[model samples]
Structure formats: C-alpha cells, structure tokens
Target: MLLGVVLTVLCLPFLWWYFFLQKFKSLSAIPGPRPLPLIGNALDVGDTPTALFNNCAKLLDQYGDIFKVFIANECKVFIANADFLEEIMTSNVHITKSNGYYLLKPFLNFGLLTSSGSKWKRRRKLITPTFHFKILDQFLDIFNASSDILVKKLFNEVGKESTDVCPYIHLFSLDVICETAMGVKISSQEGKNSEYVNSLIHYFDIFIVRFFSAWRRFDFLFKFAPEYPIQEKYLETLQKFSTSVIKKRRLEKSQEVVETTSDLGIKRRVALLDLLLESDDLTNDDIKEEINTFMFEGHDTTASGVTFALLALAENPEVQQKVYDEVLAVVGDETYVSMQHLQDTKYLEMVIKEVQRKYGAVPFVERQLEMDATIRGVHFPRGTTLNLYLYGVHHNEKYFPEPEKFDPDRFLPHRQSERHNYAFVPFSAGPRNCVGQKFAMLAMKVIIIKILKTFKIIQVPDHKPQLGMAAVLKSYNGVRIRLIRRDTD
Candidate 1:
C-alpha cells in the first residue's frame, strides 16, 4: 500500500502537466473574455444564443478578430472578419464540421449531419449526387404544387384574418421534402397536424437544451446511459414514415424491373430516394441516414429562407411590386409554375438572395480544426471550435456598403457585384456547403413567383415580424401578411 501510494503520487504530476498545460498554453498570450472559475461564460450567456454570438462579435471590436470565450465547457474562438472566415473555410479540411456537434449525435446518430471522418466521407460521397442540378426540376414541381396548397389554404381563411404564416410555410417545406425526397405527398398544409414532423422538430430543442444545460453532452451520456427510447421513438417514426413510402416505391419499381426485363426497357417515376437507393456505394443503413438528413436539412433551412424572403418582401413594397411585375410578365397562363417559369423569375431570385444575405437562415457554419490552420495571421490550435459569425459578417459595412439596407441589386451581374465569395453565404461555404443549393433556390423562386403573381402582400397592422433565432432563424410569431388577390394587371 505504501509503494502503490508512492507510484500514484509520482504519476499524477505527468497527467496534470499533459492535460492542464494546454489549457493555459499558447493562447494565454492572446486576450479573450475573462472566464469565471468553473462556470465561465455559461452563466452570462443566459438563454440568448444569437445575442451571445452578436456580443461575441462586439468583443472583436475590443479584442480583434480572434478571441476566445469559455462557452459551455470549452474556449471557443469567434472569427468575425470575412478574410479570416474565407481563409479558414476555403483552406480547411472538408471534414471540419465541429466536434461540439456531438450535441446532435443523439438525434442524428453517426448520421451524416453529426458524423465525422470515414463515415462522413463515405456517406457524403454516396448522397452528394442525389442533389445534382439536373434533378432540381422535380423538386421545383414539388415546391410549386405545395405553394399552391399553402396559398389556397391561406386564401380560404382570408377575411382580413391574417395570421403568422411561418408554421404554414414550414408545413409546405416539410410536405415538399416528403414528395421530392421520399416519394410521399404528406398533405401537411391541408391538415396541419404532423405528429412525426412535430416530433422530429421537438427533438432539436430537447437536444439543444440538454447540450447547454446538462452535465453530459447529449451523446457522451448516451454512450453509457442511453436515452429513454425518445430518440428511438423518433427514429422509428421517421423510419416508418420513410420506409412505408420506400416500400411502395420499391413495389412500383419492382414492376418496372420486371417490365424492363420483359417489355422493352420502359422507365418508372424516379425520385431523390430512387437515385440514392439505386446507388452502388450506400448500404440500407446509409440510405436511411441520408433520408433522415434530408428530412432535417430540407425543411428547416428551405422553410427559414422562404419565410425570411416573404418577410423581407412584406416589409418592402417596392421590392414586392418589382417581383410581382417580373412574375406576371414572365410566367405564362398556368395555375402553377413549371421549372422554366422558376428560372425566368429573375427579380424573385434577387429578393431571395438579398433576404438570405440580410437575415441568413442558418447564420453561421461552424468548423473544428482538422489540422493547425492560420486564419488571418492568427493560428487556431488544433481541435479549437470556430464560429463563422455569418450574421455578423453579413451585417458588416466593410464588405457590404450600407449593410443594414436591404438591397437586391448586390446580386445583379454588373455594377454592384459580389465583394467576397464568403460575403453572402446563406447557404454556407466550402466542399461541405449545402448540396441542394440550386434546388433550394429553385424551390424559393417557385413559391415567391406563385405568391407574387397572385397576391399583393401587405403586412397586418398587429403583426410585426421579429427575427426569432433557434437552431435556425424564423419568426417566433409567424409572419402575418394580408394578401389581396391582384384583380387586374
């Protein structure tokens, strides 16, 4: 017992030096927010994550571009400058999606959204082709059809009884994901009670709350002390929803496989899932993960972007009028839009881009250091967490003149052009950038064109929209707009 105590005492210093030394090492020379003992800035951050990020940007005004804050459990660096953001994003590893993203691991599993290294690489490769530009037309049709349902549903309840439309728009997006990705048309707008969609969205808040407040990071605890079948329930719900549709499609396609062998190689209707399901690399588990990733990524982001664009147009009448005219002149006498009509709505695209720039939906693309990387003369330690400060960068007057002003002309081909590649990144940056960017753009254009062509959008007197930040930017009170049907040209 005496000898064992002697050995244990000697080994303790080496362990302390290895772990504790790096905590105070190189970056101690650089200045950052003063961390309170034990708790650090966790107590100060309160419930406002967005405001906390904005204040972190403000810290750069005092502490320059690179400053650390002991947020949650670690000292995270906030990089506000476009140049530094560009350098880190463009040059960094494609796999730089954060280690702190373990917050999502319970909900996402080793799924593409939260997984790293070989799993991410393999899954991304298998699924990347699922979002090619050529496939966007199918998604455009889904968007326009869903927008019709949304508008029709809203039009019925239109007796100057304008209510917040965020949830409805999210329904449209969710429904679109069902049709476009999974080969199921869930009439979410027709009857707005979507328990599975609701459950899936519910997991986000639960995961985020636990991530910040709980002693265990959502995943770390799950490794030993598993969830009380809530995540499993959600997975089962999503799987059942997806698998039922997949089973039907496989049945339909099984007939096609037979017909192709028997009756002259005729094709059947194909979907994003069909493309993914037909792929060589993906396994059955991988296909399920890809579908789950699409369900989360498709609706949350597309809905937020569409919601913000409508809010922007509702706020600015001139922009709305310009969009209306462009739509009327270009789109033909069709009840709903086709893919070509979507491309022709130039002003509508500008409005979407401008709104995305001003109120970026998924504001910041976070990155973890894969290797030691120098961002603007400052070297970030390997394993350091970097928040992109996308909303901060968008609001910067340096890259965008009169940054607060909502100007669509910035996206025009000439005169006012792109200042930096990273300046207006609502879709995000790098190889890991949004795979469905073109489809997202097309989907938004179709919705905007359909709405602008039919209705003159006016903001309701009692309904002033405010930017509500969650996992994404959406109005807490849905955007309430009074829509008068345009009777004449």
Candidate 2:
C-alpha cells in the first residue's frame, strides 16, 4: 500500500505532461515561432511592454493571421484575421475571458469585465439599464462640468513648447468616471498628488508588471516577488476606497438625500451606484467589485483614447482642421454641446472612429474556448485561449491601405462598407464587449471638442509618443504636444 501511494505521487507530473503534449498535438496544424521548453514562447514575447508590443507585431508579420504559442504550457492561439475574430467574439458559448483575467480578480473581483457564465450575464443585464440613452444624456452635464475643469487645467500648458497630455487626461477621466458611475466625486484632478491617486496609479503599474513577468503570473510565485507587498498595499487602499464609497452612498440613500432632480427642477438621473443600491439582489461587496471594474475600465481606456486622438490630430494637420471645421459647423459657437450637437458632428465621428482603428486604446482582448473549434480548417482544442489581436487586425494592409497613415476618411460610408465588421474593434465586439462604449464615445467627444475649441493641438516635430501596453495602451514617455490657445469670437 505504501509503495502504491509513492508510485501514484510520482506519476502525477508525467500525467500532466502527457495531457499537455496531447493538447499541443491537437493544435500542431497552426503555425508559430518555435517555443522553448517549460517557459514556451514567453521570452519571445519579451518582458517589457514596448518590447512585448513590438515583438507581437513581428510575430504577426512573420506568421500571418493565425498562430499559436504556449506560455508555461498553456496554449494561446492568436487571431488577427477578421473571420476568426468574428467567430469567437460573437459566439455565446465561448464567452469566458482568458485565464490572464484571473490576475484582476483581486482588484476587480468577478465584475462584468472579469466574470463569466451566468453571473456575468446577470450582472450585465443589471448594469445595462444604467447606461440607457436618457441616463446618458443626463450624464452629459457631469461630462461637460468635468471637461470644463480639464480645459481650465490646460491653461497652464498653453505656451509651453510641448506638454504631455496623458497625466492631465488621466485625472480628467478619473473625475468623470467617479461622478457618473460611482456616485462620488473624489476630486482626483485637484488632488492628483494625493496618496489615494498615487496608489491607484501604482496599482495599475504593478498589475501590468505581473502580467508580463512569467515568474510572477502565478499567485504562488508572485508572493515571493517585491511587487507583491507593494501591490497588496495599493490594492488594500483601492478596496478600502471602494468599500467606503459604497457605505457612504448607502448612508445617503437611507437619509433620502439622493436627489432625482436638479436645482432648476428638471428631472435628473441617478448614478449607476444608485441603481445598484436600489436592487435588492446585489450586496455591498458586489457593488464594490463593479465600482473598481468601471473605475479602471472607464477611466484608463478613455484617457488612452483621448490622449492618442490629440497626438494623432497634432501629427495630422489636415485631419485636425477638418475635425475643427466639423465641430464649428455643428456646434456654432455654443459653449456647451447638447446631444444633437454630438450626433451632428458626423465628420468628427469619423475621426474618432479612425482614432479607434489606428490607435486602439485597448490593444487586444482574450477569450478561453469551452469547446473544440475549427476555424479556416485549423483545429483549436477546448481550453485554447483566443487572443483577438485588435492591433494586428487594424494594421492589416489588406483592410486598411497605408495602415500607418492617419486618415479619418477610412471610415467614410463607402470605405467602411468595404471591410469586415470585425476589422476595427477598439471597444471589442459582440456579447462580452465593453458596456460603456457609448459613454466613452460621448465623454471623448466632449473633451476633444472642448480642447479643440480652446486650443489648437500642435505636434512637436522631433518628439514622438512611446507606446506601451498595460491594462490599456499608454505612452510610457507621455503623449507630448504643444497647445496654442484659440481665439474664439
């Protein structure tokens, strides 16, 4: 009996290896760079965000649209082809997010972005109503108010030869998300140097470092790293912040101070927190998880979008002038943008869409398949992670001509009609796509129009943005551009 126990214990590693090899055999038809043993192709992807971004581009260029790689024996099949992306992205069955999202569970828990199966479906249904058109329109007041603060802050950078727009945009986005979704205003823009704000930013930094480090990906191994304690400290602060907000909002609800009307007596909408609080089903813990999720998703993603849009516009004078013309024509010297104004800026919409294509804020999305699937006659076994490389698809020359060039007209009706629907997915696509896409778009438009109305974005001739991949795409060196104050009559 003692010998049998020892033998069983000894066989476990071999059994695991045998199954791992079988999975690889099943996916052998797919092409990828040769992976090293144990670590697999992890090193080929690089340890830094910039290197990772560049190396992934090289791999795509070398291997074409569909390829597979193994990270620590885990199979990840990357899909740059639109048809393959359409299949997995639109499917109802393969909606489980890839295992990489597990890293976010400590910070975000099982919120909409990280949750799967019935829980995700339920939470999605609950949260969808909060972003309804009526509510979104009301939220415009918050957006405009926050953007006004951002425009004021930019006054300090007006005469400078170059200003990094990323930090300013980050604070603006944080304020907007807090007011619109979390039902609280932490005044992050005013308190940019505060402990809370610094900790929040550092939390994201640590998360991305862990994401790229092969040795730190697993919790068992991460605990041994220096970042573990620092991450824990920041995560605790973030969680405490979320919990405190939830409790404060709950108290406000109990006191009946939560108003559904404005000072002018117009019918006002409640925040997402109000709606969630009204629901009998969600506990405080559940609400806290979602708050953290939206805070990061809504804040960082929009910051990236607006920052890149400014850089792109700065670099492309013709495009910037065209967008400015559209804004002037649609808005007609109005200090505030109404919903109709947002709708009528058709050309600006095109520019924003092009920005999404050329510089997608969230570079890629991942999903783990639950069932065996075949795409273009290539078999992908169950549990294979499908990386929908949005960056690669957006840059595919077959779809976008002169892919590196910034051209807003690529989204013109006739041109857009020429490509596949999945070809440009900055907010991702289908069932599990971002719930705040419309919110993000309106927020971005408000900020962009405000900035353009007040200042002309000028590119620094020699300076260029250094792009890096984190929770969102960011410029490690900052998005530098000169802002000249506009003379408005």
Candidate 3:
C-alpha cells in the first residue's frame, strides 16, 4: 500500500507533463532560468516576499523582456516589454485571470476583481457608473473628513523619534472605504485598533506563502498544511464581518422610505452600497461579494500607494519641497480639497506618477489566455498563465532611462509621449483594468496633499523599504519617517 501511494505520487508529475509536453516545448524558445523536473523553477522564485521580489528582478535582467517559469506543474510566462504588453493587455479574449487568483476566492469570492466572462462584464457594467464624476465628487467630503482625522491622529506622532506610517495610513484608508462603500464608518482611525485590518494583513501573508508553495497549490495536499486552518479561521472572521455589515446595511435600506432622507430625518448621501442595494438584479449575497471586493481593493490599494508616496517624499526632500510648493500654489490655506484642486496639481500628479512607476501598489497581475495567440513570433497556447510584471515593465531601461532614479520629470508631456502608452500601467490596462483607479488616485492625492500641507516628512537614518509583493506591494520592514510641524519647522 505504501509503495502504491509513492508510485502514484511520483507518476502524477509525469502524467501532467505527458499531456502538456507539446505546449511546453512550444514555449522553449522563450528565455528563462532552466526548470528542474516536477518542481521546475519553484525554488528559483524564493519563499518570502522580499526574496521573491528581488529574485524576479534578477530573472528579468537575465531573461530580458519576456520569460517563462514553471512553478511546480504550472507554467507562467512573465511579460515586461511594452510592445508585448500592449498586445496582451489590449486583448478582449485573454481576459481570464490566472489560477493564482483562486486563492482570493475565500475572501473576495468571484467579485469584480476576480470574476470573469459574462459575470465580470455584467458586474463591471452595473458598478462602472458608481465611480462617475458626479458620484466621485460627492466623495470629496468623505475624503476631507478622513484626511482631517488622519492629520489630527498624526499630530500625536509629530514629535516622535520615527513613526511607522503604514499602520496609520491603513486605518485612515479603512475608515474612508468603510464610509464610501458601506455608508457607515467604523472609526478605525479613532479606535486605533482593528481586527479586520489585522486579519487582512495576515490573510495576505498566508496568501503569499501559499501562492509560492508547491505543495500548498493543491487542495488535497494543502489540507495538511498549517496555513489551511489559519486561513479558514481568518476567512470566517472576514466573512462574518462582511456579512454583518451587508445585513445591517440591507436592513437600513429596507426600513427607509425616502431615497434622500435617513431615519434620523437628515439628508442621506448615496454610497456604493446604496447604489448596489437599489439594483433589482442582485441579491444580498451578490452585494456582499462586491462589498467585500470593494472594501479590500478600495482601501488597501490606496493605502499602499499613499504609504509609498510618503516614503518617496521623505527620501527626496527636493521633490517634497516641489510638491509642497505646488500644493501651496494650487490650494493655499484651503481645508477642503476640491475636484479642481486635485486636477490642477500637475507637478504633484507627476510625483505621484513617479511614485507609482517606482513602487506601484499592485506590483504584478496575472491572466490566462482564452485561446492560442502569437506575439513577437512566440506562440502562446490557450490557457497559458501570463504574469504581467508591472514592476519590471515600469523599471525597464528602454521605457525610462536611469529607471532607478526618482525623477518625476519622466512623466513630463513630451517625455511621456516618447514612451509606449502601455509602458506604465500601475492600475493595469485593457477592458479588465481597475475600475476605481480614478477614485484611488483622487483619494491618494487628498491624503498626501493634506499631510504635506502640515508636516515636513524627513527620512529616518539609513531607513529604506525592504520590498515585498503579496497581493499588494508593501515594505516588510515598515515605512519609517519623522514629521516636523511645517509651522514650527
């Protein structure tokens, strides 16, 4: 019986390879670090987020723009070239996300970020209008309110030796997303503690761990792994939180008679949840899926962007001064940042673009080809997984000369015109691109501008971001900086 089990296990890889041999050989022309039998290039990718990030960059340098890696039994082709990126990103047929996204199903289910085909199309159509200019304009109040709270909260840390700003940013972002998406604020910023936030961080840690684990990729094998139970625990916690919020919001909607008035007789501002609830086509479950999706994507991605932007500003005082001067010129002494103010800060916008180019929140995205296609004379069979390495693409020397330098001028009109349109896709591209990208950019500008207005961010001695790429790009070592009150400074 033991011999039989061992033999079956050994044969599994051979069986998998036997079926896909032709498809595998077709990709042999693509350059990559050589793969070993069965496990393939699994070990080459690294175990931790930091190692994985660094190793990926090294692989890109060696393999050039496009490369192949066999992570266990799965083959993933990493594409970083702008021209090739344009072909794949613009395709309507290759919109299906890779299998790795399945790990998020426990938390986000098949919501907008993970869903595909007709379901994704319908949901995208239904939710696209929620981010319209008029609707987003209504969110400025929420942004200003949240920024005020964040500013007040940071006042307590102004004189501290070095503050880790990531946590504070996370809380502030959670507060904003909760209000904008759900119509209720949990005051995560005020409370200064959140299990949901902690759970989210832990969830990403587990996901990254599993995402690179050869054994954990299989359900049957992962059942025995230690992360399984822990993942289930957090999944239950996350689900309960989302479920309770959706139920409460639905009850409130059910009890309301007037569309513009609340039970307290106050005028009600529409939230994403309110719009979703008004839809006749969706059930409470469908709404929960979307709510969870938005709550995670809307807040976390924005927080990561703002955190990195601050880090960039801290390290580059000249650039920071430029931004501060720009902000002063645009909206001097104004507590409320208007839509026009956000649009007019072209220099600050350029800085944000540079930050994204260097440290995009979602560093990489994955997709699966729906049908066979050829690019640059290389044939990709149907169902091949493609890793759109946005970080690699943004940092490629061909797109931006001296890519490591923090120069916002690269985004200058004439310079930007020199690069491929798909060269810097921080929010991704094509039909399946992020729908809330504009919303995210506006929110980030609001918080960052608000902070810079009050404080001069100084970098901690020798502090640098130890990069990591989980679901989002974050620094494992924390973003540490000192803040001096601008008035006192």
For each candidate in turn, the TM-score is: 0.86, 0.94, 0.94
Superposition error at 455 for model 2 (Å): 0.6
- lDDT of candidate 2 at residue 99, scale 0 to 100: 81
The C-alpha stretches of model 3 lying farther than 4 A from their native spots are 1-21, 262-265
Better of 2 and 3 by TM-score: 3
In terms of lDDT, the best-performing candidate is 3
Candidate 1 per-residue lDDT, tens place, 283-368, comes to 65666767777787788888888878877787888988888778778885677687677778777777888888888887666777
Residue lDDT tens for model 2, 1-489: 999999999898677766786876877878898876556788888888887788888888898877888777578887888988888788888899888899998889899999999999999999988789998998899889889999999999988889998889999998999888876666788874367678888888888888887779889999999999999999888888889888987887887767754445665458888888988989999998888888879999999999999999999988899889888888878989899999998988999988988889988888887888876687778888888899889998878879899898899899899889989888888898889999999999999999998999999988877777756788888999999988832
Residue 422 in candidate 2, Cα distance off native in Å: 1.0
lDDT measured at residue 423 in model 1 versus the true structure, 0 to 100: 72
lDDT of 1 at 153: 73
**What's model 3's overall lDDT?**
0.88
Which residue pairs in candidate 3 have backbone atoms (N, alpha carbon, C) closer than 3 angstroms, thus clashing? none
Q: What are the RMSDs of all candidates, in order?
A: 4.6, 3.1, 2.3
lDDT of 2: 0.86
User: Per-residue alpha-carbon lDDT of model 3 for 234-307, expressed as tens digits?
Assistant: 77877887788778777777877435676588787788988898899998889989988998788878999999
